[model samples]
Target: MGNLYLARHCKTAWNLEHRIQGRTDIPLCEIGIEEAKMNVGFLEALKISKIYSSPLTRGRQTATIYATALEVPYETRDGLLEMDMGEWEGKTALELSALKPSLYLQWIEDPRNVPLVPGSKEDVFTAQRRILSTILAIYKENDEEKNVLVIIHKYICSLLRCALQGLELNHFKKEIIETTLPQNLSIVSSQVIEKCLSNC
Candidate 1:
């Protein structure tokens, strides 16, 4: 019954440029740093005691901001990493839509059916499984009252949101997850809960 708060990392250069950054390992941009700093007040309100972050620099850096503000320990977890975009790693969502309209539509409308790479299978299931397993382990390790923070990326966030909603991966588009810089969510017993967006 512990509180789990999931946050998407702050903005990045790739983010500013409208690029899809799945597993690209890009660092936070200046705006990203400022955004992370701004998240301190929001996280402070949540009273988080510990943070778990994706190993990627963006997630790590964002996690540091909240952990420092809350005076808590933070650890990086590979299981929290972003989804692998394969050939689409560096392309913008707009670019994908323009270059491969049908594929892009499939990605947006039914992500589980379309491969990130043109010819490969979609890895949504794998990403969801890895992230869920890690979140569950963390939930098990902590007491029910502790408020835990998890910093991660957009695609991974989508998968996590889907898992929390008790929906299949293909239904990801049905719910809107806040993916803007430093978006927040709450979890209890590993179940994701949608709270008021203004409060998050």
Candidate 2:
């Protein structure tokens, strides 16, 4: 199987403040830029042939640094956008828990059911199966030993991991993924995960 690297986007204002960026279009904060630079190391090692990113600013900026380092122009793909958090765009965790209690509870209980903000839900990679189809299509059309990086959101990265491993989605939690992925920079690939699992 070919190698695919799914890297979470760098920090954002919301990321720093613990807000749910969802499909929000906020630029990266100061720390996010440094984090992006550090994370670009692994990607540069891969010698990525083509880079793809969410059309949103955060995602694009995250990948652009890597693209510049790799001397390749990054490509934007709408399919790879982060999930739309709707009203939760820039609300902090504490704020949401306190102010939008019921909605927040529902969101924590189940994200799919929450009413999405306009022009947000349509751009999400919510399910693993859907992402698999999209990624596989990209692979099928561009067959080669190419390494690619898709800079996306934190949760979407987990969902893609779930899809690659065929893990159950509902029972899947984001915290588990947080601990598993590299702290500032992480690499996600079907082959790498499989090898790690096999060794385990």
Candidate 3:
């Protein structure tokens, strides 16, 4: 019954510009690097045994910092990758709203019902399933470990939060979880993971 610490990657240049970074492989900015370094103290207290990260650069960079600081091993997993935004990859929310109002509105109001954007690989529901399965697998693999760290993107974090709260994907925006996580680290207790697996 290991605990999973899900962390959002630090800021990036695109993050500063408010761009959608889905599968874009953007690196962390100076501030992001500093933020990761700053977080090491708190992470160290958790005594994480190992790290799993998304293959994207941002997630990798954050994981590297934590791994180096905590002296723990880290590996990248494709299943932990960000949702593919396709044509919407580099656009900001405001830009998307202006360019495709109906689709953007659907995304905001009910992500589960939003049509896949042109060139998008998976819709919100698909992304949710992928993340949930990935997390469950990781939890099972590290059952003996006391704590495990997983570095991922904001969208995936939001999806996991929705699932952990026993809410549907459509509740993403409507719930208190918000579209963005409050901080870098989110603690997913083993009990909650067990509950999620039963319902999954």
TM-score list, all predictions: 0.85, 0.74, 0.86
What C-alpha lDDT values do all the predictions have? 0.73, 0.62, 0.77
In model 2, the runs with Cα more than 4 Å from the true position are 99-101, 109-130, 175-200
lDDT of 1 by residue, 1-200 (tens): 45677778888999899887877889999998988887787677777878899899998888887778789999999889887777777887777877745576687776766745563344666666777777777877788778888887777777777767666657666654545434444554433322211111
lDDT of 2 by residue, 61-85 (tens): 8778888888886788776766666
Q: Per-residue lDDT tens digits of candidate 3, residues 113-175?
A: 764656897877778768888887787777665688888787777777787778776776654
Pick the lDDT winner: 3
Q: Cα-based RMSD of the predictions, in order?
A: 5.4, 5.8, 3.2
Error of 2 at 119 (Å): 9.8
Native-vs-model 1 lDDT? 0.73
lDDT of 2 at 150: 64
